[model samples]
Target: MEKEIYSLRSQFEIGLVTDTLVMLLDRGARVPLIADMPQVIPMLRGLLEGGLRHRHVYCRDTDGVYTEVVVFKERYDLELIESASQIRHFNRVLAKDSTL
Candidate 1:
């Protein structure tokens, strides 16, 4: 059987980050596993002064004080891959959007 790859894009508080993972189906159930989390926050920030706004974008401290991680979700898996690309097609898309 052929395997399907699903890209996962997360809306982190620090910034936007993307990762590629594989989706496995077992007994008609779908499961996903991440392969990488390429740090695209800096690159994304350059495009927009603020950051990506998403409902899931949040911060969670692990070790307490100075350690945290942001989370984001998307409807389609392909969108994640597209957002991960370094091409930067939508440069300054939020340049004027004060809300960010």
Candidate 2:
């Protein structure tokens, strides 16, 4: 068994922030546990920006409260493990319209 990893990208659209998480097919049914997922809303953008792997990304929820379950990383200890987070964080956080 191995630790499964999930990554995502997000961006702001109009006035609301949209996010998307990508789970590789290779992970199979071993997806990481996401207890009470409905409450975590920062997504990859704020998560990676606020330190996705180094420390728990804390952000104010819809009610203006903070939580430590923003983004958690798993099985990411390959190389430059400390830097993998930033490497994944890129400029394209929001999905673009193909017609545009």
Candidate 3:
């Protein structure tokens, strides 16, 4: 995570991505895994509600899955993230737009 992002998360009730999740942008993941993150993050958010804790998110890859534990801020935006299906569709549109 960037220092600025960490600061923002600390000061504001907003969302920020973890370093482990950040790597997913460069290295693609399995479709099911991609689809599952939104659901998982929310479940994790629910667990950490009103508490300071860390949750481990397992990244699924063709080789296998790797674990990345993230400390979600207490006020992380649970409603900001969209569902995996929505993400998939949005990404498809971006891909198409880039090709045009």
Write the residue-wise lDDT of candidate 3 on 11-78 in tens digits. 21112234322212213332433444544455545644532343333332333333233535432322
In candidate 1, stretches whose alpha carbon ends up further than 4 angstroms from where it belongs are: 1-38, 52-100
Q: Which model, 1 or 3, shows the larger TM-score?
A: 3
Candidate 1, lDDT over the whole model: 0.27
The RMSD (Cα, Å) of candidate 2 is: 14.9
Can you tell me which runs of candidate 2 are displaced by over 4 Å? 1-51, 70-72, 75-100
Q: Model 3 — which ten-residue stretch has the worst lDDT?
A: 5-14
The CA lDDT at 3 in model 3 is 27
Compare candidates 2 and 3 on lDDT and give the better one.
3
Cα lDDT tens digits, model 1, 1-100, are 2223233342222323323211111111122122123343333335343444442221222211111224343221222222423223222222222234
TM-score of 2: 0.23
The per-residue C-alpha lDDT of model 1 at residue 99 equals 38
Which candidate has the highest lDDT of all?
Answer: 3
> Considering every candidate listed, which one attains the maximal TM-score?
3
Clashing pairs in 3: none
